[model samples]
Target: MRTWARTGSGLVLGACTAAVHLLLALPVAAALLVPALRPVAESVVCRLAGLERRRIVVLLGGTGGRAEPPPARALRYLATRIPVGLLGGAVLTLLGIGLTFAATLLFSWVTQTPWVMEREAAVVVSGLLVAYYAVPGAVLLYLALAGAGGVARWERTLLGRLLAPSREEQLTRRVEELSRTRDAIVAAVDDERRRIERDLHDGVQQRLVALGMLLGRARRHPDRAAELVAQAHDEAQRTLVELRDVSWRVYPAALDTGGLAAALESVAERAPLPVRIHCDLPVEPPATVRAAAWFVISEAVTNAAKHSGALRVDVEVAMVDGRLRATVRDDGRGGADPAAGGLAGLARRVAAADGAFTVDSPAGGPTVVTAELPCA
Candidate 1:
């Protein structure tokens, strides 16, 4: 029922657009022939094409990313599409006529009006006459609907072939995108390096300096040597722990030795809040993909622990149609900004790996971060 309704709606919209195209056909051709009016014609045609592209996407589930064709190509498209639009309009008109006829036939039969056959006619004769009309009416209705569907497919194909970007244009766009991705990766790497430097200076290095001071004090004063020595030992242990943490932030050894699951498990265990992890993978992803997934999860978990005020986090990783999908959800205050510091870096990292990353964090609720990376 839903499919029928959607198809009916699309056909109606297509018929309306076809009428508009027919109305514009003469003026557009005349304008294109004049050099002064050529730009104006091109502008109008581009806008119309854009509207049709959007219509196709919304109604027919057509692929997007339509590029405006050149003026010459636009004129050719308009010329070619007029006839196709007429075909669509004709199909819709036939469908409407069929529906009207069926409605009239049923109405006249139900009310026993003389409009259908006759009020004095025999029942057997009336029944045979109605059956004779009904079978052909049904077949015509079916043909009309089928024609509507075929017209829709033809329009989508024509639009794709005429308005889609050329191969050279596509290559240029890809090159621009690759360049931007390269720059973003470089910036992210530099940011990571700076963060590591700050951590070493403020955390592990500070602890090492304190441990050195404690040991020096013990050596200088023998009367309190045992107490100072014990303090130095405790400080040394803290320094080692801080060093380990810094190293983990730089790059987890578990990623290389234990794979993505083990690495994520270690993260879950160390988080300040409870973290539930579910990982199901048919095969191990490439190393780059694994690293990208791990970082996305790790950064999300860290942000949740530090800023979200969340009680618990959930992490799920799986293989979906040859892509590795990793999702992290935290039950906390939302409002995570993807354009801001760490999240922005994560986006760039995912882009560098040719993956898609999304952050959904509405106000006063849970936050969800997801990354999809191609493993093939």
Candidate 2:
């Protein structure tokens, strides 16, 4: 029922746009012929075509392709679509007439009003007469609805043929996407390197330097050597902990030994807030895909714990179709920016793995980060 309603609305809208097309057809043709007016015509036609493309996208749930058609193709499409729109309008008009006729016949019969069907004198309406007329009315109404559907389909196909990108254009677009992905990977790698450097310089390296200084002082001053040695032991332990953290950030050894689930469990164990993890995978994903999924989940959880001020987080990982989908949700302040360093790095990582990444964080509430990686 809802689908039929949408079809009906689309047909009405198409009919209206067709009327506009009819008015502009002659002037558009004239403008195309005149060198100075050609650009103007193309501009107007492109805008109209864009409107149509958006209609198809919103009403029919289509991508409508990546690129717009050239001016010549746009003109051709305009010419061809006019008739389809008119046809839809005609069907709708017939449907309205059929409905009106049925209503009039029923009204006359119910009230026992005298009505003339032809040139004959007025006669009282009867149930048999109403039934006799009802059959054709119902058939006409059915045909009208079917025609509307057919016209909608025809319009969709027409737009696809004339407006959608060609095979060569699609290949070009794919190449451009790959180029961008390569650049993002390079930048992500560089960013990771700098992050590691900062951690070593500010944490483990500083701790080690202090340990060396303490040992040197202890060797010179034997009176306080015991105290200095104990302090040094504590510093060494802290340094080991920081070093372990840095290593895990680079790549979790658990991923290689126990797979993604085990690695995620380790993350959950170490997180500051409560984290519930649900993992369901019938078969292990490819190593690269697993790594991408892990990073997405790991980074999202880290962000939530450190920045979102969340009390609890939920992580779900499963195999959907031929892809692995991982989602992390935090019930804290929203407004997580994808352009931020951590989230951007996650995007780059997913793109490198030929996956899709999305973040839905509205103000004053939960933040949800999801990534889908192809298992192939």
Candidate 3:
């Protein structure tokens, strides 16, 4: 029943589409002959072509491509569709006639009308005749539907070829992408600088001021001077540690000295969660790619440890097919979103280096974040 219904629907839609294209094609063809109306008619045809493309995509389940900028490709697509639409219309007409004949035969038998046959026949004989007409009519209907689908598929292929991006368009898209990514990179750099400045001012500067006051008090009270000196020394050491941490966060020196593997190992050691690092890379990637890889792993681990109530985290870095692939997995509560805040920033950072970043965090248990950077 469903199949029959779909067939009926397709036939109707095919007929309608065919009639519309036929009407539009005549005006477009005539307009081409008249120089004054050619451009206006072509523009109208392009709009109609867009409508046609949408119909093919939605009703026929086809990915009809779009022409870049100019309407020449669109014009060609419109011209080609005319014949295809006419073919569909013819099939629908034939199928409709067959179905009508079968319905009329059934109605005649039901009413005992002598329109179909002059005399009334036996029950078996009537059933046999009805089956004969109905079977062929059903086949015709199915064929009509199948033809519509085939034509739709063919049209999609044709449109794809006609509308495929030109070299100029491809280059233009690349330039735009680069421009957007560059702007994002600059913004991220500025944000990082501001954060570092705030951390230094609020944390290390206050500690240093308190340390200086302690040292000055120690000079005035010589008896308790030893205790004050020790306290002042501890404060100085803590300030140094904080400064080093800030510097590392900005750009780890370990990346230059020990390569990406060693740098990732240091990250694992610092993470709040018991992070296990497994890195296997024969050589170092480009500086930019290495930095992006480090950021991806570090951020992923930090996010997991902070948000996920996880016992352990795992980090894996490998070089595969001339690309650096890093994955950070945690056994904790998931549901990590990649669209906003920290994750979104990380995505932009990776994209700036022409790398790919992905996060797979469901709900209950495990979260996985993967990044791939071209080592070449």
Can you give the TM-score per candidate against the true fold?
Answer: 0.82, 0.81, 0.61
Cα-based lDDT for every prediction:
0.84, 0.86, 0.78
Model 1 misplaced stretches (Cα beyond 4 Å): 33-38, 65-75, 102-125, 130-139, 210-232, 256-261, 276-284, 316-322, 331-333, 362-366
lDDT by residue (52-87, candidate 1, tens digit) is: 777777777667446566766666666677777778
Candidate 2: regions farther than 4 A off: 60-63, 66-68, 115-120, 130-138, 196-244, 256-259, 278-284, 318-325, 331-337, 360-366
Residue pairs with backbone atoms closer than 3 Å in model 2 (clashes): none
Query: Candidate 3: where are CA atoms >4 Å away?
Result: 1-161
**Candidate 1: Cα lDDT at 269:** 86
TM-score of 1: 0.82
In candidate 2, residue 273 scores what lDDT? 92
Cα error of candidate 3 at position 320, Å: 4.2
Model 2 poorest ten-residue lDDT run: 59-68
Once model 1 is optimally superposed onto the true structure by TM-score, how far is the C-alpha of residue 165 displaced, in angstroms? 0.9
Error of 3 at 8 (Å): 28
